[model samples]
Target: MQAPQREEIHLNVPSYKKNRSGIAKFVVLPELIKSLLSLAHGNADVECGFSENAALITDDRSSLSDISINGLRATKDAVKFYGQGKVHKVPICKGLLDNVKEAHSRYQVDQEITQRILEKKEAIVAAAKLTKHKELVLVGKEQNLIGQRKILQEDLENVSKMLNEGNSRLEATVATKNFAGVEMAQLLIGGAKKKLDVLKTQLGDNSDQMNQLKKN
Candidate 1:
């Protein structure tokens, strides 16, 4: 069997446009130049030339692949060299370009993942700080409750002692015939005992609620 013959293809070479001073030619790809010119000048008749190898792929596909490959290589070089800011101008071969594009996409995904992790860390820190502040406020409220409980206990003890003394006085006065002094002492002692009981109940309820909040 005969090997397939390699075909020779002819292409018209397009001249690069030089500035009026002729110091340097614009370093853009030919396809980009054609597109810009067509867009700017409204599709004037312009001739473009390419070799058979260049024309093997459609212009759009070739240009897109070239740009993607170039961008990938640039990114790779930048990372490898630690932000050296130099784009390695490597030629875009088909297989190499595909691999580079895939790597670049993965790199982008990795960057997004890293960013999300950092944001989550920041959010966690903020939440922790808020929790700490709330704990501090709870501590202050707990201290206040303890103080109130102590005061209520002291008041209850004083009222109980007075009530006992008042009963003793009533008994003695009943025997000694001092009715006015006994009645006055009984009224004052009873009111103080009732107030002290109410305070104790309120303090007990407050303590329970505070404990529940701390558990939560």
Candidate 2:
């Protein structure tokens, strides 16, 4: 009247009932059970170390050598655990505790010295960057002065050409004996020549100043 019974398996009892899935319904993962059972105190240890490590290895510490940093961190963790009464976790023996203590003290001193060296290196790098910035500013100023000098020289040449053209035209007009409009033409030409001369003088002075700046 009843089907043959499958073997019953029990959680931690080695005998329990199985569901249709063929797994022991009363059985559970041992590790999961242990973890759940340990929650009797309803407290958990948050691994703050992951976040601390993330913060510590910021942009500045990202460049640290992996091997050297790993060694330092390992030693630091051992010291912290030992100080926190977790000495059993650390591979330290009571017989050599004195030697380990002395070594830890020396490690602390070396860490302080390393910290100072890093600070000095940062200061030196900052100073070099400041000097480089000053040099760049000076170079930009020189380039600007040179460009102004070039512009002034070009302007002087243009004014000189205009002055020469005015003089040549006046001479041609005189040769033609154009008496009717000669006076007005001469006035206009003279005015233009005067303005051109003034401009030429200014440009020439600017050119000289530019050359002086170049020498300096």
Tens digits of per-residue lDDT for model 2 on 120-212?
999999999999997787677778767776776776577567657666766777898766556665666677677667767776776776676
lDDT values, one for every candidate: 0.68, 0.67
* CA displacement after TM-score superposition, residue 203 of candidate 1 (Å): 3.3
lDDT of 1 by residue, 30-106 (tens): 55645654564432332222332344456576654554555655556555565355445444469767886798798
RMSD of model 2, in Å? 12.2
Q: Judged by TM-score, which candidate is best?
A: 1
What is the Å distance of residue 17 in model 2 from its true position?
Answer: 81
Estimate the TM-score of every prediction.
0.50, 0.42
Q: List residue ranges in candidate 1 displaced over 4 A.
A: 1-96, 99-104
Q: Which candidate leads in lDDT?
A: 1
Lowest lDDT block of 10, candidate 1: 5-14
The TM-score, computed over Cα atoms with residue i paired to residue i, of candidate 2 is 0.42
Residue pairs clashing, model 2: 8-16, 9-15, 9-16, 10-15, 10-16
